[model samples]
Target: MKINEYNVVAIEYSLKDANTNEQLDTNVGGKPLEFITGMGQIIKGLEAEILKMTVGDKADVMVAPADGYGEYNDQAVQVLPKEQFAGIDLVQGMTLYGTSEEGDTVQVTVTNFDDNEVTIDYNHPMAGKTLMFTVSILDAREATDQEMATGVVGGVASGGCCGGGSCGSSGGHSHGHSHGEGECCGGENHKHGGQGHGGCGCH
Candidate 1:
C-alpha cells in the first residue's frame, strides 16, 4: 500500500553527516525502526521523505540544515556560576541536565570551565550538520483503528491502553507510538507528531 498518514512503516536507515561523512545512527543488528506517517514521531524531513516512498523501496535523502536541525545559534551558549554545579565534577564534553528559564529541564554540554565560571552550551549536538539519510522501507501497512486511536502501532492488544497511565506489559517494546510526557530510553518525553526538543539529536 502507498505510505500515507496513519500507515505504519518499518525502515532500516543509516544516518550520516553530509559534511564529515560520519555515521551518526544506523539500524544494525537491531529491529527496523517503525513509526506512523505524519505522526510527528519522526523528524520532519525524514517523515516527509517516507511519505513519498512505497513499501520495499529505498532512497538516499539529503536534508539541509534548515530542514533538519537548523543552523547553530551562538546565543545558546551561556556561562553559569560554578557554584550552581555544587557536587558534580565539571569537565568538557560532559552532559549536564538542568532546568531552563522556561522551567523545562534541558540538557546542556559543558564546553569549558574555570574557577568561578562554567561554560554550558544548549545548542543541539547536530544543529548545524546536514543530515544524509540512507533509508530502506522494509514494510508498510494500514494501521488498525485501535492503533490509530492511541497513536501507537504495535505491542498492546486491541482495547488495551499502553500509555498515559494505562498499564500493560512493561517489557515489550511498542513501535510507532507517541511517548507522551514520559521518559523513554533515559530521554525526555516525546510527543507523537510533534517537534522534538534539543536533547536526543533526533531533532
Candidate 2:
C-alpha cells in the first residue's frame, strides 16, 4: 500500500548530526523502525520525505532544525532557586530525569548552578542542529485498530535521558512517547510524538 496517512511504515534508518558527523542513533541490524504515517510519530522533515517514498526505496534526507527536532527555545531555559533540587548534587552538564509540574516524564540538563540558584534547560538535547538521515523503507501497511486509537504501535512507556533512577531507567538515553508538550521521541520507539509542539529528535 502507499504510505499515506494512517498507514504503518517500517524502515531502517541511521540518524546523525550533520555538522559533527556523529551518529546519534540507528536501527539498522536490529528491528526496523515502525510508525503510523501522518500521526506525528516521527519528525516532520523525515516524515515528509518518507511520504514521497515507497517500499524498498532508499534515500538520504537532510532536516533543518525547525522541521527536524526543532529550534532551541531560549525561554525554556529558566534560572530558579537551587532549593528546588534538594538532596541532589548539582553539577554542570548533568541531565536529570523527573516529573514536571504536570506530572510528565521529562529530562532537563543542569546548565549552571550557584549557591543560591540553578539554571535548567528543558530543550531537547539535540534541539538546534541539522539532522542527516540515511533511510530505507522496508514496508508500509494499514494501521490496526489499537494503533489508530492510541496513536502508537507500542504500549505507552517512559525512560530517562542521563541517569534518572527515579524514572526507573538504567541510563537516561532511552525515552518514551510523551515529551511534555512538543516533540516525538521517534527513533526506536523510545520517545514521544510532537503532536502539539511539532516533532523533535528521538533516541
Candidate 3:
C-alpha cells in the first residue's frame, strides 16, 4: 500500500554528513527502524522522501540541518559553574544529560571547562550539518486505532520500535527526546544507550 500519514513504516538506513561524507549512523545489518508517519518520529526531510517510496524501495535522501536537528545557535551555549557538574569527570566534546527547569530531560555537550566553570552547548551535536540517509523500506502498513492513539507503532505498552530503541538508535525524534549519540528513545523514563555517532534517533 502507498505510505501515508499515520502509517507505520520500517526502514533500514545509513546516515552520513552530506558534506564530509562521514557515516554517522546505520542499521544496515541490524533491526529495521520503524515509526509512524506524520507523527514527527523522524526528521521531516527524511520522512518526506520516505513517503514517496514503497516497501522494498531504496533511495538516498538528503536532509538540511534545519529540517533535521536544526541550525546551531551560538546563544545556546552557556557557561555554568563547575559545581553544577561536580564529581563527574568532564571531557570536552562529550554529551551529557541533565534536567531542564521544567523537569524535561535535556542533552548538552561539554565544549570547554576548567576548575571553576564549564561551557556547555545545548545545540544538538549534529546541528548545522546537512545529512544524507541511504534508506531501504522494509515494511509499511496502516496504523491500528490503538497505535494512532498512543503515537506508537503499536498500542501503548505494546512495545513499539522506540521501546526497543530501533527507530531512535542514533536518529529520530518524537518529543522530549534527542536522537543524537546515545540519547534515550522514550524520553525521561528510558535509559540512554551507549554513545554512538552524532545523529538523530526515533524517540
Per-residue alpha-carbon lDDT of model 2 for 17-90, expressed as tens digits?
A: 89999887776787666677777767778889989998889999999987765677776676777777676666
Q: Candidate 2, which segments miss by more than 4 Å at Cα?
A: 87-91, 97-106, 154-183, 186-203
Each candidate's TM vs. the true structure?
0.68, 0.71, 0.75
Q: Report the number of the highest-TM-score candidate.
A: 3
lDDT at position 136, candidate 1 = 88
Please rank every candidate by TM-score, starting with the best: 3, 2, 1
Model 3, runs deviating above 4 Å: 155-203
Query: How many clashing residue pairs are found in candidate 1?
Result: 2
Candidate 1 per-residue lDDT, tens place, 88-188, comes to 66657665553343444454567888999878766655667788888888899987887677666674423221111111111232222333311221122
**Candidate 1, residue 101: how far the Cα is off, in Å:** 4.3
Q: How good is model 1 by TM-score? A: 0.68
Q: Sort the candidates on lDDT, descending order.
A: 3, 2, 1
Which lDDT values do the candidates have, in the order given?
A: 0.58, 0.62, 0.63
